[model samples]
Target: MTTSTPAPTEAGLDLVTRLNAYLEDVAATLGIRGESCSVDLTGPVAARMRLNWRLPGFPERDVDLMWHEEHGWSAAVATHSGDGHHVVVAYLGGRTVASQPRLVARFADSLRAGEHQDCWPGPPMLRTAGGPSALAKELAAWA
Candidate 1:
């Protein structure tokens, strides 16, 4: 038997849609060809979602993106091997370069080129945080 996940709220859906569109544009700008790429709404109240993309001759990749009205945005890329992960988070004073399409494009380019050294190409402010649950809680309250 399978359990169904509830649909996200309209507000949640809208934010995810916007983020997805930004990434899609970034991919296009970088000339990263993919037969199909899409975003999944993972946690609406948490303002969480994920993007999956697969370029020709390569395995797919997943990137978790989240947002908080006060904190801005954050991104997490989980290694396919399930052994490691990378995170890009908001900076001091609640500033974030993570939402910039060009930066995300560079990250995708680095991954595609196999030049990702210990999650290089990340923002200078990048660091590991307590994880999504905290952000999710914060977003839930705001929602």
Candidate 2:
């Protein structure tokens, strides 16, 4: 029997490129090095960014920001575990997909001050179920 692999969809590629650019914007807004930002285009499409400064109360732990297609943006502390797990501290709960870089920087600033009031206890509820292509369309207007 012969098997063939399917090519990556154009929408998926577009989403990846756009998401990478978004992460770069976020890093620039926060004054973080570009190398500290990364995006995972597989599955649900997610991005992770590491801040140079630590969280206010937890001086030893590093702060990280994450974004998911279904959950928007979140802040967490990178745990000591080498398995890449994090302790979620807050969720930036307005839009379920994307938030502007300035808004993200503002959120991070609030987190550093230990006075962030806009945090949601859990990840934001899903707003769209159309998956990658849908997310790409939504991110199209991101600037």
Candidate 3:
């Protein structure tokens, strides 16, 4: 299986830009109080991509900002991938949920639209329920 690393490229940055704009709009729609939603500056990608590609019922987390009193994050989004940026949502004092509905929809849209690269972990790595892969382990880690 391919590691979750993406190649750094201008195209990847493009995806990140779209994510920033799209998230801004979503935050406005729900009147996201405060700057709860934002693009992470320290993220590996220059910007975050917002594509409607993801499973249903997942919530979006502003990965841009992670807060940990113990760890004390001093920046936004901390994932290191060439895919541009990962949606950063730091609820509950700076923990992240990988399977947020809003985030999934955005990612799924990008995948379906062919705008972003296919970053699925692939086969044994692709997350699924009882599909004989790391899906169970990954999901369990989240729980």
Candidate 4:
């Protein structure tokens, strides 16, 4: 017998849609062309985006951004080991998990300008109490 994966619930689909739109807004705020960025929402409560943005000294490395229901947004770089791993480099450090797109854009700009703070070698601990449902509700206000 074969078992198939469960389909996403309507709530989960709505959350993904909102998250995708938010990432698009962030790209617009940063003046990044659509082709230079990509967002992934395959997971139930997490999302990831990749920007064709390179730091001044590391022109070959692309910037990776991720958001979780609990941890919000964090920036990272793909590890050099070719093992499909990323190293967390900076956290948005905001009070809420779902911050305004403009604020997230500012965080990206800071990273580009080499002035970012809140650097950590690993992903930070949970920063928000609300889970996916709460995040979906918060994003609903953005509509």
Candidate 4 per-residue C-alpha lDDT over 62-136 given as tens digits, one digit per residue, 9 for 90 to 100: 667777666778887877777757777788866666778888887878888998754444555555545445666
Candidate 1 versus the native: TM-score? 0.38
Looking at candidate 3, what is the lDDT of residue 106? 51
Ranking by TM-score: 2, 4, 1, 3
Alpha-carbon error at 10 in model 2, in Å? Answer: 0.9
In model 1, how large is the Cα lDDT of residue 75? 50
For each candidate, give its TM-score against the true structure.
0.38, 0.87, 0.24, 0.74
- Judged by whole-model lDDT over C-alpha atoms, candidate 3 comes out at 0.33
Tens digit per residue, CA lDDT, model 1, 1-143: 01123466655444444444554554566554322343334433223434455432344555544433344444555566876454542222133423455665555555546554534233343323333343333334223
Candidate scoring better on TM-score of 1 and 3 = 1
TM-score comparison, 2 vs 3, better candidate: 2
Compared with the true structure, model 4 gives a TM-score of 0.74
Candidate 3 residues lying further than 4 Å off, grouped into runs, are: 1-8, 40-143
RMSD to truth, every model: 9.0, 5.4, 16.3, 5.1
Candidates arranged by lDDT, highest first: 2, 4, 1, 3
Q: Rate the local accuracy (lDDT) of all candidates.
A: 0.42, 0.76, 0.33, 0.66
Q: How many residue pairs clash in each candidate?
A: 0, 0, 30, 0
Per-residue lDDT of model 3, residues 1-143, tens digit only? 01122553554444444444444544444344324543433333222333222323233322332222122222223345545454332221123223333554454344334443433322121222232122223224322
